[model samples]
Target: MRVVADWARQESWGVRLEWGLAGARALGPGSACVVVVDVLSFTTSVSVAVERGTRVLPYPWRDGGAAEFAAQRGAVVAVGRRSVSEQQPWSLSPAGLRRAPAAERLVLPSPNGSAISAAVDGVPVIAGCLRNATAVAGWIVRQGWGTVRQPVSVVAAGEHWPGEDLLRPAIEDWVGAGAIVAALARSGAGPLSPEAAAAMAGSVGITDIPTLIADCASGRELADSGFAGDVAVATELDVSAVVPVLTNGAFDDAR
Candidate 1:
């Protein structure tokens, strides 16, 4: 299978775009898995929720007007942020979500992550982050979907335009994607693209892991907003075995 890594919409080739509801609409249906990466926190949040055994209903902040739509269907609604802040209602950590009652719905508002989830349509969607990289990759490989025919697209939910200097979010995603690529390679799946190879190679040699990512643009923004802990929480690898699969506008554990 071919792994296409899109840094952003405008920077993507063949089929890729930056984070937006519009970019998500362009996703075509094929034997492909859409791996959405909002590593700074959103994907991290979804991964946590799945790990805790709660069904997540991801909606665009605007469509939150329809939150009742999901609640009626027995799913919890989570809204993220448009900017960084620790005061947000739900924490992006597994322990936090686990502490909440299963019947409770979480409304989240995030700058980038939720918007990307809202935009995608059709195809099997999966949440991506360093914390769940191995589980996700192993699941994909076990599906036995042969390469060259089955395509895997890793979408990076980057910051809004003009605020693109936040390298942490993208770097976190690249590292996660690299880890996935490496896992796929071990299965003798296929060859890695130069970008994927670089991501894998780049994840090495960071003395202070938390500080390395926290210093990135997104990390700094979160830190300044008092959500620095979220960045540190988001960057950890394999914290949970949950693999959240986007099915019909809600997130369910990938069996």
Candidate 2:
């Protein structure tokens, strides 16, 4: 297991890319920062919440435990998209969070992005989305991460199959991660692993990112369920200057 893990680490490269919670774990150790991307929503929602002055806590599950977790921290727990109401507008939907009143703190739970964020330890965890990709990359470069001595890992939080833990690699997340990787490269971060390079290449020629995101499987899933607004919010590329960085188990604006 150790041998397999070491081989998968991509440790020789300054920038590495991998998928889901397990990917976060594999690349987390010794890395200076781990960036988690979930465009069709978790990271996107985090960007919105943090931009609104909310400290976002990444909780791994949306189960009842999330309520207790939020209670312990005196924070509100964001509900599922379908569970959102006028009285409980805070949800994983970026659109919902955009319209919700500003919160001092929020416990945002999800199986993908939030789970990956919660799983990474001993390094800075950054929330990266289309909205803040350039900001995130600039922050990472400024911190002198993504070098041979201090590597950076970008983890794509792909969706899980309904009623199962099986991961379905969502294209929106791939491109979202790609946006960060590409930005990092442009910011002078180097020696990208093949996986990271592939992710960067994946985002390269995306002329109409909003339309691409809206037509993707994950985007369509949200759109078909009457949450098209969420997709719209997630596709606002480079519009945000807030860099949400996890410190003390909560994500807040770093710049």
Candidate 3:
């Protein structure tokens, strides 16, 4: 095993924030809990599905293999947002998931959020989004995770460039992560790292987050692709009380 500098790990703080897959890897090892923020879709969809009592298995890739993985688990696999149809409605879109019939389990795949969630190991993984940010924070505190002895890492699962490996550093996910960090701070769950504090501060001035999110690049892309309702569903701040925590290889309501 290669030794990583403690500085890179943000080891001094109770709560820390980082971006994308590399971020999750850098901070995940020492964290008591890692909150995965993918506000535009993956985490948001998990929130919606878990709220409706569905266990969501986050598949790292949205490829043909996802169906096989779901089939092995006897779970319904979610298709792409634009692929939802009359016979098969479940997709990465939160609004679509909300409208889909309740199932015992679902396999939701994504290149960003689900990839991050699937990569992190050992520590408890909690899905955090705009709709359940406060709830997720409180649950982390209740689990005694956000303390100096047992730190928490908040990871923003940013989007990838089309057909590219480059991360987009999505504003919506940054804000979503900030919302959770802010809530955690309010609950006295942190001696937050500078990065975490910055995330919280970033969320402090967003007085019109709904409009800001809707007008953002990812949001506009989804809107142009006819998934505008997904954006609307994702921007509903703190409306959900469900905290979806990954347990036994799947996300289920922990609230």
C-alpha local distance difference test of each model = 0.59, 0.90, 0.92
As for lDDT, the candidate ahead, 1 or 3, is 3
lDDT of 1 by residue, 179-203 (tens): 6566556665554444545555665
TM-score of model 3 vs. true structure = 0.97
Clashing pairs in 2: none
Worst 10 residues of 1 by lDDT: 9-18
lDDT of 3 at 12: 87
Error of 3 at 115 (Å): 0.8
How many clashes show up in model 2?
0
Q: Which ten residues in a row have the lowest lDDT in candidate 2?
A: 1-10
Clash count list over all predictions: 18, 0, 0
- What clash count does candidate 3 reach? 0
Model 1: lDDT of residue 170: 61
Best by lDDT: 3
Best-fitting candidate, scored by TM-score: 3
List per-candidate RMSD values in Å: 5.7, 1.3, 1.1
